[model samples]
Target chain A: MDVKAEIIAILKDVTGLDDVGSDPAENLFADGVLDSMATVEVLVAMQDKFGIQVPVSEFDRNQWNTVNKMVDRVGELEEA
Target chain B: MHNITPYSSPTYFIYLLLLLSPIMIGLYNGKRFRVYETFATVIILITAFFGGNMSQGISLICYILFEMVLVLSYLRYRTKENSKNNFWVFFWSVILAIIPLVFVKIDPLLNNATISLFAFMGISYLTFKSVEMIMEIRDGAIKEVKPWEFIRFLLFFPTITSGPIDRFRRFQKDVLKVPSREEYVALLKTGTNRLMLGLLYKFIIGYIFGTLLLPKVSVLALSYQHQAPLGLSWWVLAYMYVYSMYLFFDFAGYSLFAVAISNFLGVKTPMNFNKPFKSHNIKDFWNRWHMTLSFWFRDFIYMRLMFFMMKKKLVKNRVTMANLGYLTLFLIMGFWHGETWFYIVYGLFHAGAMITNDAWLRFKKRHKKSIPSNKFTECFAIFLTFNVVCFSFLIFSGFLNTLWFS
Candidate 1:
């Protein structure tokens, strides 16, 4: 799978919601799809899978609140 | 050489406005008078600290110097090419950053007196900013730490004493640029509105509730303590609600003044309150109340600790991990408030509330179909949350300690 698809898969697995990635711009936090614990789990999974370190300080909720945003952030991190 | 506490009185506001007029004019014409702004800030600081508060002024200066060295050194280490980002260095930097605050917090316990050599107004809030910078630097999020910008961010006179705890990046963004005339006009409108609201909240409503009602209710609560179980009476309940309102209005009022003056200075300081009593749950209450401090705690302490634990697989169960996180966060918060039994109990009480709230949420989710959901339920949830929060404030107020111990 592509990076985007991989991230969406991770989100689904972490949140236990099959339709988590249905909307690319859905707010995972506001919609209650991802709580603090699930968000941490997703971050951990991403680090393990993609080898990108996202420090808690650098994690802006608004910037990473959606599947599309998460994929884009991951891409940016990969490039850096 | 007159002493003036920031946002303390009408006279202070008048003096502040007079000082800010030139800055406001500069911003209106799409310019930042950096030198004049610094001059005005120095004058304000001198008035705030140099007169009756001379000792605090000295302490603040020493503390700032200590933090600047620590932070700049850390930033240098972090920014070096191929730096290892040593954990011990970062760890020690944070510890050193918080040591003054620790001394101030613990001095009361050691001496049975509130005063401490390290104690100064806004020490806790200043420590928050310094520690935040260090953390972000370690994360490689902060690439540069200019000395002037660092000091200005820490000593931004309006919110220096008690912050809405503006982030370094956010504050830098506004401080580095002068807003357009239209933006400045909008900011001025909002600032004026906030100033008026602050007057109402602090002088009028807060005065009525806190100065007028609180003392009378306190006396009543104490007098009626013998007639009720565990010294809990209608009067005590009255005192709790009154005290809660007083706390909210007074602090929120002060926060408003801070934010308003920040806007006038062309910086968009984050707000601290958001109608907290309207919250439907304990977690929601935290998000709405003392928002900046809570967000700071959430970002720096709670989130970081939780992430570390989950990453290391330190705690196997997610629920247990969250509970532990809440416990640590609130306990530290309690201790941060002061070294008092009531403060500690207040922290533990909130932790328990949060854990129980989590359990109820999970159970409700499981039984979503059976659990009735409607307008009444929502209102009931808000009412229940309000009472729970008021009770927490009662614990925080230390009136119980006075009743039982004193």
Candidate 2:
């Protein structure tokens, strides 16, 4: 599966919202795509899918803040 | 006999100062007079020595440590903005909060159910605040802190006893601002109003209703003269509903008082209740009643556990089987309430009620569109859901003994 697609699917499931309309660059938490705990849920779900252990430190408010940033994080971890 | 009443406070003078000093700190923060905010917290904590119990002392210490850990880490990583520290903080903070709860709270409740000498004045609030702070810190949302800032943050005594569960970022901004005399006086009146209303709820509503109406209803139910009256069950059940509302009013009223008191002293406290009796359904009720406490459970327990279950495919058959996913969520809720069977049952009962309510709503929305919306239908559902919640409280009352299966 494409990593971005996988990420998007996980976000969808975690939120239980079928259509989240935020831009990929918009912060998931602040933009309300994911709430505080849902953010953790999505992070954990991403890790399970890709078999990567994203640390809690990766939950920074910015940088890995949006979908695209979170995708980049997955890429960094998978490559590592 | 020398008379004593609610107006009397053994620690009134010190608490007054403890409450007042925060104003100066808020004043200083507003004046840009202080370099660090945590110092105010330390001074207030020094004042907290006059508090009633050891549990309170431990809670005070732990809250500050957890706050410091998060604040220091946030300050360290705020600029560089990598998430490794954020990850560690969240991971560690969750563990830090849960370990104490498991060992100190749950274990004892299961074993002896002793309400410890320390029953910790504000354990519930502190746990929520500490965990939320760690998450906020990891997000780099908190910009600055000094020791005094932390004291003001944690030990602002009004919200210390009962809480509106103020969010840190929102609370921090409010703490930094100074209230004018008018605003301050208005806050005092508001606090007084809440406090007075709370007394009415607690003494008049929760207390009098508990004694006069609730127990009488219970006794009648238990001691059937010839046969258990069919209507007697409804009476006991109805009064239970009223008592439960009174209980929330009592607690939420106290929370509002604390919020108002904090506001009067120039601190912002969030609104805790939204007319819970008006909640039409279980989810809505939880969202309305003891709201901060419920939200704490949602953010800390439910969402994380649900995510984990979904990841493992444990919840895959959940809707179909009604077996695992939501049950686990409820069990967590139960355990979060305490270690007794009552709490567990209470948790599961709520889960079952809420799921049923949700399914029913979806069915109604889908099928009953043709039926005109009526106050009767709306009020009937609210009536039913209220009865369900009150019935669940009965399970909690016996939580320690009969929670498992009885």
Candidate 3:
């Protein structure tokens, strides 16, 4: 799977919501689907899957609130 | 020379308005008068610290110099190419940043003295900003730490004394540019509204509750304490509610002034309270009450610890990890408040509440079909949460210590 699909899958797994990928731009946090704990799980899953280190401080809620943004952030981190 | 505590008196507001006029005009015209703003900030700080509080002024300068060297050095180390990002270096930097606050907090115990050589108004809030910057730099969230911007963020006069605890990135964003005319106008409106509300909350309602009712309730509670079980009487209950209101109005009022002044200055400092009494759970209460501080704790302490534990597979159970996080977060928060027994107990109490709250939430999720959800239930939840928080405040009030001990 591509990075976006993989992230969606991770979000699906963490939130237990299958429709989390319906809108790639949907805010998981604002929608109450992804809370702080769930956000941590998603970050950990990314580390395991993408091999990118996302420091908790670098996790801006606004920037990472959507699946597409998470994908972009992961790509940026990988490049760096 | 007159000492002017931020937002302390009518005269202070008069002086502040006079100083802020030019900045407001600059913002209205889409210009940021950075030099003038910095000059204003210096004037405010001098008035706040250089009169009768001269010693505090000296201490604040030393603290700033110490933190500047530490943060700037850390920034240099982190920005170096091929930097190893040594964990010990980062750890020691945070420790050194917090040492002044630690000395101030513990000074009361060491010499039975109320003041410490390191103590200064807003030391705790300034320490929070410094420690946060170091942590962010380590995390690569903050890539550059300009010296002037760093000092401005640390000593941004309005919220410097007691904070709504603005983050470095957020504050830097505001400081780097001027708001549009429309934005500035809106800010002026909001600032005006908050200033008026602050007056009502702090001077009127807060005075009624704190200056007027709190003393009477305390007296009644104490007078009836000898006859009641566990020294708990109806008067004590009244004292709890009264003190809670006083605490909310006074602090929230102060926060309003800080935010209002910040708005006028085009900084947009975050609001500290949000009708906290309306919260339906302890977690919700935290989100609504003293929000910046709680969010800071959630971000800097709880989230980091949880990540560390999860990363290390420390406890294996997510539930256990979360509970431990709450325990540590609240304990640290408690100690941060002071070394007093009541403060510590207050921290433990909230930690316990959070743990129980999490379990209750889990149970509710499991039994979702069986449980009824409606307005009445929602109201009941709010009522329950309100009383629970007020009781916590009572413990925080240190009356229990007086009632039981001296």
Candidate 4:
């Protein structure tokens, strides 16, 4: 229902898992929500879902490394 | 139209280097030309279009048509939420792509299959890249793409010939941004090195090997008449394959140069080779060698053949039938290389070898409890596979494949 819940659902869908527990700091990749191409794929889905284009430069940056970080970044993109 | 012959005089070198001077000036003027990596190839296409003979013009048009498919796909993806039936669109695009190739290779007056295009169809590869994008879209793997990004992926001039066969999404990402300084330097250095190596391999090794081996082949055909030489016939045929191996490495080197430069310019063209020679078996070799091309065959033709066979109830036993599936796939692959009868046999030859190799692996698994594994056996199999590959190429282009069989 909240941003955190949405992020967890996204991660679960990506990883094809039943549950991703409620640690806002939980690692999506380590918890098997994603693999090596995780960051890019998640970032892409997020952009497509939200209809916002993250800056080309931000892709190489560390902002999309985690679910919380990515949500915050996407929120920023929307605001901007 | 501009001339497109690379086999012509050294004038193209002077022309290209001088032509690039203006683009460099445009870069200095802060133009937005840094948006794509295949920018360098635009110059070549321009040159060909301006001065290329009739055939070259035809090839150029085929190339543009391929670029158009990518353009259309990107636009449709942007506008539509869902396109479940994009498969047929891509299929027709492939058929359209080959029209130019057919017209160029066989004159329209003679060949009934001619599509009445002006020239040959060398741009089918670009069509493959575009078709892959459409497939990805149908699979719901990509949500959207930019127009320019799609153009860069399809028409990025550097890979216009003998491609490394890049994937759509990955290449789209690669071309979206400018290259960092370090990346640029690495790309420039590697690209130049490979370009030099390609020149040497093609001009020097290919020419020299052809000169040495071809005459001997002609002499044998002449002198021996009907008598088979000192049983040296097969060996000579094997030697005839030297040019093919040389040509592959040469073309591969050119592709590497093209892709590396594209990367340095902030475009991410996919790598085409992966130590193909070291593969222990035919299937493994296919996986490593010209991987993108093989994948193209798999996605467009092979998978369809397999599904078709299944649907037709043509395959009785699952395993044996599956081997037949692989057989048809590689044979189709061989034919795709060229349209000649030699290419047909070549494709069938590879299909047969790969099927036999797979059968042997299954056999080995069943007998694993009785026989211990040996490095020697594995190494021997690989060595033998290389010769088998070499021999297949001989049939693809040499006496037996062309004259004996046909």
Candidate 5:
């Protein structure tokens, strides 16, 4: 699966908000697609599926708030 | 020379209004006279501490210095190049921040024999702020930490006692910027209106319900405690509504005063209540009532619990996980209120209501065509929610325990 697609799917599934109009750069949090709860779900799902452990303590919503940013983060973490 | 809690009395408002004039003037003239603001804040804080309670004042000072060292050190650790952020460090920072509050809440449970020396007014709110800062620092959301700015945010007098808890970044934005003349004028108008409305709610309506009516209703209800039907009667119902009203008016009125004061100083603090009685369900009620505190819980507790459960794969079913989350969140909230069976039950009651409400919502969503949807139904939902919430308040009031046990 495409990383971006997977990221978007995880967010929608976690939040139960279908048809979230996703621009890769669009902010999920700011747009009300992902709240703090949904963000947790997304983070956990990412770890489970992608094996990327984004520490909650080090999670910056601003930097990882968009699908593209999240994808990039996963890519970077996976590489590391 | 009685030291009263902030905005507790009309005289406190008089003193506050007088003290705020220069700050208001400075903001209106496009100048944030930082020095004057600092001096005024000190005076008010001193009044809160020494005017009535010297012990609390000393406690407050100790609490501030302790939190300052912890936060500053945490910030430093976070910024270090190879610091390999340890979870224990973050955990301890948070634990230390709330240690004072933990003792304070537990003090009442120790047979009321020993008081927690760390107890002080606004300790819970301060702890909330400190914990948030630590989390932000760990997240690298707060890149730099200045001691004075951190202190200013912690000591921001408006909403200090009871907060519509402001976030550090959100508050920093307001603190660093001067509102335009037009904006400042609007803030003044809104602030004054809020202040007047708060006065009406707290002093007028709250006084009528809490002072004049509550005692009478309580006596009436107590007198009829054994009237059957589970220690309930018409008077108990009346007590429920009266107590709920008193709670709402008193807290909402206090919130308005806090927001108004923040606005007067050109800072727009968030609101705490949003017509909570109009909620259609228990979940909706939580969203509307004590909004900041609930949101804080949602962000810090519920969400985190959800993630932890899912990561550990502790609960297989999502619905069950959500239910557990609500239970955990409210139970903690209940315990936070005090170490009492009544408080715990009150928390469980809401958790049960919310879980049921969510199930109902899911059912309704699936059966939208069959389920009746109309103005009458909507009205009925509001009425049902209001009554249920009132009953919960009755439980929360501990009147049942008093009637049955005491």
Candidate 6:
């Protein structure tokens, strides 16, 4: 799977929502697909899947609220 | 000399309504009288602090100054490009923020010397807000801090004592805007409704359940427990239900008043309870009950711990990491209630429930086809969750210890 698809899968699995929708720009937190707990699961899944580590201390939901933003964060972490 | 706890009785609302009338009129006219609002806030604070609570009044003043310096200093450090270790700054700031609260909560357990001098009502709520702001600063969620605005947020008196703990950013947004007339109208209607409901819940219903019924059932329950083997009987169950009702009505009623007052002031403070007894599981129960506090825990304690565990590779299994997070989150919460065996066990009991709830949910997901899906099952889930919660409340009430040991 591509990075976007992989990210969506992680969110879907964590939220237990089959239709998380396909808008990468949509706010996952705002749209109610993910809450604080689901967000943790998504971060864990990202780490387990892509070896990308986003430290919780550094995690701000506003910066990483959208799927696109999360993908961007993951990419940045990977590069760092 | 009006000795009043905030919203504790009918008289407080009368005083509150009189004080807030000018602000409400100003808001209805699409203007926020900042000076008047601040004056009213000061009046309420004075009434809360100095109205026969002289020591706590002094403590509140000292605590505010202490936190003001600590937060402003931390904010200054945060803005520096080449600052001291960010971690230690964050660590010390949080510890200092909570030090007064620690003294307040732990003082009762010591019995030797009363550190009540360091104590004031609403210290815990203020500490939660202060620590949250520091963490937000660390994450750059709060990029800038104004000292006066920060003080206003901390001392926002509506939900001061027991909060549906408001966020700094959210509160700041509302504080900076004067809601439109239409919006104020809606807020007035809803606010009145909420306040009336709160009055009904806290005064009437809570009186009936907590004041009237609790003592009777508690007496009977203890008497029966003394005679019964294993100190358990139907009277114990009766105590559990009655105490649960009392707890819900009393606290939820206070939360409603807090939210209602905030709404009247045009802040749209978040709701604290939402049909919590109808929750289908333990996790759902937390989402619905004392929502602000639980969400605070989820964001600050539980999620952070889960991420830390995953990042450090402390546990290989993701589920175990989540479970451990629940335990830590709840144990800390339990400890926060006070230094007591019942409270600790209450926290552990909820942690166990949440873990089992998680496992059951995962299992149900896997066995969806075999599991029945109907109103009966749904009702059964609600019933089970309710009983489990009531049982936890029984532990929390400290009645069990009194019954068995005392």
The best candidate in terms of TM-score? 1
**True contacts reproduced, candidate 4:** 0.00
Across all candidates, what is each one's fraction of true contacts kept? 0.72, 0.16, 0.52, 0.00, 0.64, 0.44
RMSD of 3: 2.0
The DockQ leader among the candidates is: 1
lDDT of 5 by residue, B207-277 (tens): 99999999999999888877867778789889999999999999999999999999999999989999999
- TM-score of chain A, every prediction, order shown: 0.96, 0.84, 0.96, 0.67, 0.90, 0.90
What lDDT would candidate 2 get against the real structure? Answer: 0.61
**Residues A23-62 of candidate 2: C-alpha lDDT, one tens digit per residue:** 6776665554554445656677777688887544234556
Give model 3's share of reference contacts.
Answer: 0.52
Q: Give lDDT: candidate 6, residue A62.
A: 86
lDDT-best of 1 and 4: 1
Q: Model 5's CAPRI class?
A: acceptable
Task: Please give, for residues B259-363, the per-residue lDDT of candidate 6 as tens digits.
Answer: 889988999998999999999888889989999999899888888777667667889886787788889999999999999999999999999998998888778
Query: Which pairs clash inside model 6?
Result: none
Q: What docking class should model 3 receive?
A: medium
Candidate 6 at residue B66, lDDT?
Answer: 88
Cα lDDT for residue B94, candidate 3: 96
Every candidate's chain B TM-score: 0.98, 0.75, 0.98, 0.79, 0.97, 0.97
Q: Point to the candidate with the largest lDDT.
A: 1
* Candidate 1 off by > 4 Å: B112-116
Candidate 4 local lDDT, B1-406, one digit each (tens): 5566442233444565464544334333433366232456665765555464556555566556555665465447544755455556656655664555555445533747555454433355765776666555544465576666666666666566557777777776655544555655565576556656655655666556665666666466545535665434544654556655664656565566566545434456766777777878887777677777886676556554554454466766646655676667766565556667777788888878867875676576567678667999889878887778777766665555433543
Candidate 3, DockQ to 2 decimals?
0.66
lDDT of 4: 0.59
Cα lDDT tens digits, model 1, B179-216, are 99999999999999999999899988999999999999
Candidate 6, A22-74: lDDT as tens digits: 78888876555675666777877888899976656567678998888887888
Candidate 3, residue B294: the lDDT equals 94
